[model samples]
Target chain A: MDAYFFPIIVTGAFAGIGIGLLGVFIVGMRMPFIGSCISHTAMVGAVYATLFNINPTLGALVLSMLGSAGVAFIPNNRKNLDANTGQAILLAFMMGLVFLAVGLEQDSRSEMLSLLWGNVLFAGWGTALTTGSLTVALMVFSLLFNKELKAILFSRSLAEATSMYTHLVYFLFLCFCGLILAVNLKAVGGLLIFSLLVCPAAAAYQICHGHKAVVLTSMLFGLLSTVIGFLMSYYLNLPTGACTVLVSTLIFAFTSFSRFVLNMND
Target chain B: MKNCVALSDILIKRGSHTILQIDQLTIHAGEFVGLLGPNGAGKTTFLKLCCGLIKPNRGNVRFQNQCISRIAPGRIAHFRKHIGYIPQQAEYHAHLPFTLREVVAMGRNALKPLFHALDKTDYEIVDSWIDKMGLADRGRQTFRSLSGGQQQKALIARAMVAEPQFLLLDEPGANLDPNWKKQLRETLDRLFNDCRITALLISHELDLIPSACQRLILLDQGRIVQDGPKAQVINSDFARQLFGRTITTPEKP
Candidate 1:
């Protein structure tokens, strides 16, 4: 258990911080469904890579980027499908590809299931290192684009008017989000990653007054969820990803309750 | 002979409808111009084109003697830093995650390089604008927590903190109550009279224009019907035809 602790801790920390940061953007954009879309897309990518005998995470990264680009390429006009419908179409198409890949791999079904549910407890040192590096890279990217991001988060038109290549910045953000989801897919599972991405940040948003506070609180909530959930799963012999998401859901519940109480008091 | 902005052979089409078409127009330096039009008359679209938020389907837009459409894509950001744009205020989410002061600071931040942090001068400028907008006490409050009037004042401060030479406003005074509107009017008056900023303001309210504008341009069905002194343009029969109502004579400033 001691020997395995390092990988587990690093995995939890990186996933918490990365997903928490991305959750801020995702929630702000009002695109909660996109996180689920990205995660599932990564799952499809991972299965394909396994079939080709390559590094599954790398495959997931490339395919998830394609998934994000797919969303971006959708025409946003009255003559085309709306953004939500476009995303839904991409998600459905990706799921079909995922099923086809699974059906072809007769002997690798269990291996794919492990990827789907995420066996974070057994992820190697390589996975941990990848997660940590991606997390650091994402943090630096956020810092570098801080001002442009604020303008964008406020309004895309305002950001463009200010002379920022808002479309480029927006595409880069979606790509980064896809990358984060891809790295975590092995440890957090496709079905459960949405909870990790949204619940902690949503909980933090209910209480924090400033962007810095909200981001910090979101990271803290994500970290708490991951650590506590890992311990509970280890001790009780439960599913790690499910335990992690349930912990996050519980935190969201607690935050909502506290917010209600505070509002009533006011 | 010097023009701050020039639009030539401009045409914009959305779907199948031609939203705007202009052969030639020039806005000189140190001018406060009011843009008026009926609903769907492409006033906002024209502003977007001037600000370089949208590219004209045909022809060219020149700003500060540089052809905006011809400038390298990478240089657009540098060009935009000298222009301030104030968008219409809507109900900003109550949990928007930025304070009024931080929002104002964004203006300065936009002008600075990515690797640079806000320094003393930036903070001073941000604080001065916050104070000027009467948002000093509310600076520390989340923008979403501020009242609608306070938020608009904060947004105006954010736009002005950069101290841009050119300003574009889109019905900024729409949501403000009478008192706040009066304060905004005074602020615009100072910006135009004292700061000598080149400004183009778009509004449906005829009364707000006369006090703040020296020149006026009226659009009808996507074409400029009148462009001249505010008094002449507003009182013209063409203006009446576009507005579908009589234009009241404005008192001289």
Candidate 2:
């Protein structure tokens, strides 16, 4: 592989692993919309950052954190505003801001466009390093706090009742999720990143029996999707983000189908 | 006996409508109290207030003489760990992947310090509770796969694994069959008679309350209408009016 190909491949791997692991928790929590909300919020940050001549990644990270914090702190009263409804409102608001920023920009919109439709092939050493560091931090945090995370995922009320520092853990988890999405936005693109966050973990859920099994399987599926997607993009000259999402979707489809076939036989 | 939980001048309102109101209520340590009320009488809300899940709009909920609301937000979890709380129904996503064993193991999470894993002894305690609840064979099964009664039993086991000083159960006997109900009653009796765990159990079905429960508190229209010994409360004209004449006065257990 060429020198440029190495960084591209490495970036894809890190993005795949990070997004995949985060997906299980997001989907398990029944908040799949949160991924979309945070990603779009990051896009708005990146867009505005470009307009103001600031580092788009830093802006994305800060805004995504703020967005996730809003979600985490908002009261989830069903009578007033539920979490999903809150996320939907945030998503709409972010979309509006992104468009406004884009319209205001006087410079070339290539960087902004690249963020919307990611190009992993153009990933440099900086992208690979950032993605790798984030992936490692996420993995470590997940491993170290496995029991607490599981408790929160199982039932936040029960976790709180049991005195498990649930609010702190949940806030930290959301922040990490925001950070990962923001960093990966340039390589994977905001529009299609949610697919990587949902499909691989969801595919693992179709076949895995236990929590640990589901997590490991999801990680493997994520790795497979990104690597295979990268190879396909190289050979077929397709969009990297679209290719990765398609691969992850196919994996999910295959697992769901296999599960159905097995159940039919039984 | 000292007060285990005390609610003074407590008032909980939702948009100007009072859900629960009390001037004074105290549950003594080692007391097995059964809370009886009609639907929307706010028994669940009462339990939530005691455990600091919900703050009262007006007054204080004190546990062991310290005000729960006054406790630092960071230390509230520590206080809650000493009290095991079982909601009427734990709302979790259908796709949550934890097995029954893992769910039960969560009881220990609050007791241990942060970053500390469950040790072998902790697992042993969890396993023992699982066996006690007759879920030994189903430990590895996904929690969602269990029947309603089985799931309730598993949650009970989860609460008991921590060996809490106080237990707050809300309609724990719901969805249980006669056999499982008897088992639950026996478990409560043992916890009261042997373990001396202070408990406040909420149940609509009078028979589901353990025979060991000595005190009964009746609620109606957001107020405490009756508080006395179980037999006295059951035989009161007000309780009879509320429960109807179908409930007959019984010999003391």
Candidate 3:
């Protein structure tokens, strides 16, 4: 294997694990759209940063935080707009900003295009370290707040009524999710990362019956998808992002089919 | 007895329409009260107000003499630690992978500090409640797999596992069959009579109310129409007109 491939593989692994863990919450909460929204918002930040000669990662981080905060704090009530509607508005606004930023760029749009369809082959030691660090942070947060997160996922209202500091926990979880997506936006294309953030978890839930089992299985599937997808892309000389998404979708399809067969047998 | 919850000049509005309007109401500590009203008569709204789940458009809801609305949003959970609220329908996603044990253990989450795991004693308490609710064999089953009545029992177990000082149940018996309803009544009776846990139970059917609940409050069109002893409220002209028939109070268990 080429030496440069080491960093790319490491980055893919970390990104896969981080997004796979986050997918459980996203899918459990029925907010898979959040992955798309945050990634696009991060794209807007990255393009504008490139246009202004600033650090695209920093811009992505800041704007994605803002997007997550909007989703977290939006009043979900009968009189006011709900969180899903708020997220849709944010997503549309971000999409518009991304296009405007792209149009305003005077330099070669290669960097911006690479972000839309990620090229993990260009990843370096720095990218691997950042992804690794963020993925570790997510793992620690999940461990520390496992019970609280479970309660919140079960029902935010019930968790709040039970005095679980639900708002704070949920806000923190969203902020972490935004941060993970922002850092991985460059390595995993904005267009394809939502699959990594949702598919593995969806597949895990298809076959797993308990929370711990589902989370662990999701992480395993995430790791397997990225590693296998990377090897396939390297051998076939295909787009790494598209290959990863295909692998993830296949895994989900396989799991769903297995679950269907088992239920039929029962 | 000290007042547990006091609502004064409480007015709750959704948009321009009024949902609940109560001038004054007090529930004393260690008292079991049954709340009765028609489907849009604001029973759930009243319970929500008492639990600080929603703020009223006017007036105060005092918990242990502290105004809940005046309490900061972050600090309201501190007050809620003493309350176990069971809504009519718990918002549960169909695919959530929580077991009955974990669902019951959530009650302990409120009492413990952040990041603290449920200890053996907590699990023991949860198990005892599970047994009491007659779900001893289904601890490992996913919450979604339970029948409607079984799920209700699990929720009741969840509420009771906390040993909360106050419980607010909304139509807890709505999905329960007669046998389970009888068990629920006995459980409520024991909790209220023996443990002295102040409780407000909302039910559309008068038969679901436990025998130990002495006070009854009747609501109609967002107003408190009757508040008194159970028999008095049931036999009142207003209740008779509301039910459109005479309702003989059920024999005490």
Candidate 4:
């Protein structure tokens, strides 16, 4: 086995579990753009950190956190500036900043682009540590607040009427998504990480009828996609992030097909 | 007896529009009241205030003699557990993954502690409500798969599983066919057999309001136009104007 094989396996586990569970919340709430918004903010932060010679991960983490909270805290009743609108505006602003940061540090231009496409083969133990901790924290939160999450997924207004602080719950959930994206920034890259957060969960949604089933199936799909895609990339000398995203997309297509066939029989 | 819900100088405004303004009102304990109003009459807004989901801009809302806003934020869940709120049926998304049983079980979520699984008693309560609502076979079916009336029945079961002291229904019968509407009326009547549990049902359909509600409260342009016995209020010109026709007695089964 190659010396990098162990790191690859660990990184796969980290990205799979963290993004998979977080995907359930994102998909259940029907907000796919949240993934894009958070990842783009992370990209801008990474570029800025590269220009300043700082740890890119820390900068990415802080900016993405702000972006997530900005989108989540938008009042639900606002017709002009809802969550989706806010996220789109933030994403556009971050994209502009990312380019500016890249241009400012012409010497580090490749370094900034590296964050966009990722180079997971050289991802150090720190990547594993960040992803591992984030996944664990998210799992604990999901366990403790299962009921509240279910209520919110069913209907935010009804949940609030039950005297639950649904707005707080929603904001915290988005923040966790941001944290996960930040932690996985190097392993999957900003552009492809959203695929990891969406495709596996979407495939799971086609086959699972219950909440618990959907979450578990999504994690299973994510892990399988990551491990297989990582292996394919290693043997073929291809990009790990693109391979992983493609695998997830294939899985979603398969599940959709199977669901269609099953429904036809009924 | 103290009022279950009391409002004083209540003003509900959205931007520049003062949607609802109530000088004073009291819902006594153990009374079934029907709220009648036209579109945009702020019936739903009033129910929201009563449930403490929204705070009035310039007044106090007291529940059981204690102001809702004054209670510690953490303790509000305890207060809310005693009230059942069923929003308009249209609020439910058809694609939600909940089954009939799961929907009903949500009623008990507020009473249980966080992270705790449903105990045997919780399941028993959930099952009882499903059965009582005539959804015995539909328990396993997804909420979206059921007919409109069945879905509404499941929602009612969800609200009642808590055995709330106050039940607030917001036009639960809208968008239903005549047959389904009759079934809904019967189901509501059966659920309110105990006079100890007060109820305030909001509806525009005169024929759909359950016969058990003794008092009728009418709202027009956000103010209470009439509040009295059902017979007296139903005969008024305001009632005719609200309904846009001569009011006839609703038929009894």
Candidate 5:
């Protein structure tokens, strides 16, 4: 049991790094709402999976990929809030279905809540392996595509002009996001997933400018927050998810202020 | 090599705005053309049409008798590989983290990725261009750290390092003080004379245009008001009405 729990803790922290990595892309794209949409859709998929007795993680992957595609193809017109609106509708629908599932289950309300917050203490060995492998794989692929991704971030049309298929890159990035979102499910929970995506990178951007620094600093901040949050949760016997979010928030705010001071000095 | 761009009766409209309405524009290779107009004149729009960055609602832009719209996107990049575009008031943020050298190296990105490690040859070329732009000492400086004129020089260097067959300059002299304007113009004139790069430059400040551009196209209200050889067009009655100045040839008397 201890063996299983220890690796799960390591995996949770590892997946936190993936979230941090994803956060860099989000920040680079200047689209924070993307994470929220992905998380909401992932949760809906989680619900579908639970109802059908399938891997909820796979369910999350399907919905998030769909969500990313939906956003990507949406007409550039402002009215197509389809991405965010889709998230809202999906979030409510999934919550209703999960509540219904909760009612039909023999498990107690607390047990269902445990799944919602993702009790890292009970994360199984299989969960550890799945999340760890996916995170590592995603990170490696992103590194390989860094230049193309950088070109995309700078100017999509220019990237396209240079024979880099900007759309294909975006599609691949979404696929990566979906898979990584699935992996992060155990640590962040589907509901609170976006916090891990936004906080660390946003804070890092407050201090850094270029993609290189942003990627490195954000990942560091993310790993720090995840490790610190888990330690706090372990020592204080408090809720883990809340602790993680709080720590990230504090770090982001602190970094923002420090950057402001540094800018003033310069 | 005689490279030429021909646009016949190119017409374009955006919503209620007629962005570009021209009869015929033939820019031959080894010629620098000045596109002059007031604000809101479709100068940049016309350049965009030629570069295929934006398509005209009517008519088409052609290079060497090949339609720009018909070119595949990948081929369009290859087509654009020979085109240099320096947008107006290019704001360089030092925050982008590219030094003067790296930014100029982006010119060769057609051959490699933006982040791929540059080779010694690439750096050598970058060094040559940096010196050309008088930015040799400032090669290591961040983009935003440079002064306004220096930044403009760097931006031009970045665009020109590719040694494009065609160069487009949009308000290349915009916002620069008179001294800087002259400096910029001298640099541009020197580049055009040396490389014989076919170029279309847009500027509202007609006086800033160098005499080396033998042809001029005047645009206002999104339509070509005047198009002809520089001497003929500048001395015409329309030029007087447009700018409220009597321009005459020295040989006229």
Candidate 6:
């Protein structure tokens, strides 16, 4: 069937959908920096996995999740040493990852570029299956836990008093974030996955007040970015991953500026 | 002091500095404990320790015959469900969108799981508490929209809505005028009169301590230098030494 590419495209769209789902939690917590940090850190992990001849996705997933949790654990209120500590730790870890990749044989460099830049045009049916399953699981979790998440986000101590465990909820959220991040590496690559996660949610948040509405609109925003980015890349013969990210960034900026103008008029 | 919350030879340290050293303390329930301490007297820290919000490096806070920690967090919620805590000069509650009724519903927050939507009956209970506080018309108003006096009253209603068995407020009355303070104290008296809700009000202002309170616990330099009935502690040498000034009760006006 010449239309065989349709299902594969649909599978890639699942990654687009995950963008909307994860975006709400990221923006709600006011922790978009956490998403940015984990994404680049996953790249380092991917390169390390390549050197060891391991499943690079697994390496990226575990390291990104741990890095997310570790950032949360750092005491930010002590003096002026808040995000500075996170920046230092992330820098050191990224350097270590680069060095490990340098130690690999020179012949593997071409293959490793696929993981870094993404080769969405060459995506196979198996990649589709992986992306599909991850997106489904995330959808189910978000639907079931939305109410509980809302209460905890209000106040940690108040949530604890109400018998809601903030630590457990936060940990599960990171794990879910890590999974989406790992799968998206196949499409947008690690360095650019953040736009898929942050931009759409931010744009949605600008217009929508309700949490569920924010999630839905963000998914729509993400899908629009993906389709437009894909067509632009195909027509211009540019790198698909970079095009997708740049388009999403433009959409985000456009929406944000419009909201700003509207607010000023009011 | 008899049937008291006693701390025998208590030692509290903060990174090698022993902040509080106490040989003994005896405070009975149902007494309005005006916990007065100068700045850095560890008043807030002591109150937090009593609530088990933070664990001491050593020594324990006890009530009656049982320790607070051995009690489950659920049971503590049940215990604190009855205690209304007013933090000192509460500054952060402004800008919230919730109506006074919704803010009061936060007291019931200690009741159950996050997903358990508070039903119609819970709203009615909160509505009634507002009516009881003489704010029936203003009940629909958001908490931040009210004057400082009204906000404190709304907060008190929030704290007492679960009909907490004990009420712990920290310097909440500092913002209001003398008349408003009296109104608040009267409201508290009426609110907790029938119930056995033990009240512990924290304030830096010594004169603001309600006359209805039978006992006064004077804290200075992280130690309880004076603990006695209002008349005994008022203008006593122990009170003056703890205060670092001669004790003259504020004019009634």
Report the TM-score for the A-chain of model 4. 0.93
lDDT of each: 0.80, 0.85, 0.85, 0.81, 0.71, 0.67
| Candidate 6 residue lDDT tens string, A37-139 | 7776777777788888888888888777777677656543333565656656675667566556856648788656766666576667887788888888888
CAPRI grade of model 3: medium
Please, what is the TM-score per model? 0.91, 0.93, 0.93, 0.93, 0.80, 0.72
Lowest-sum lDDT 10-residue window in model 1 chain A: A72-81
C-alpha displacement of B134 in model 5, angstroms? Answer: 3.0
Interface RMSD of 3: 1.9
Candidate 4 residue A68 Cα shift, in angstroms, is 3.4
Ranking of predictions according to DockQ: 3, 2, 4, 1, 5, 6
Taking the tens digit of each residue's C-alpha lDDT, what string does model 3 give over B134-247? 899999998878877777778878888888888999998887778878777877887677678899999878878899999999999899999999989999998988888879
Q: Of 1 and 3, which scores higher on lDDT?
A: 3
Residue-by-residue lDDT tens digits, candidate 1, B48-156: 7888867888989999888897666577777788898888763234357687888889888567766677889999999988988777888788887777667767777
Looking at model 3 chain A, report the run of 10 residues with the lowest lDDT sum: A74-83
Better of 2 and 4 by DockQ: 2
Q: Fill in the DockQ of model 4.
A: 0.46
DockQ of every predicted complex: 0.44, 0.57, 0.62, 0.46, 0.21, 0.18
User: What clash pairs does model 4 have?
Assistant: none
The alpha-carbon lDDT assigned to residue A148 of candidate 1 equals: 71
Among all windows of ten consecutive residues in candidate 2 chain A, which has the lowest summed lDDT?
A: A74-83
Q: What's model 2's lDDT at B180?
A: 71
Give residue A215's error in model 1 in angstroms.
Answer: 1.3
Error of 5 at B90 (Å): 7.8
Q: What TM-score does the predicted chain A of each candidate obtain versus native chain A?
A: 0.92, 0.95, 0.94, 0.93, 0.84, 0.85
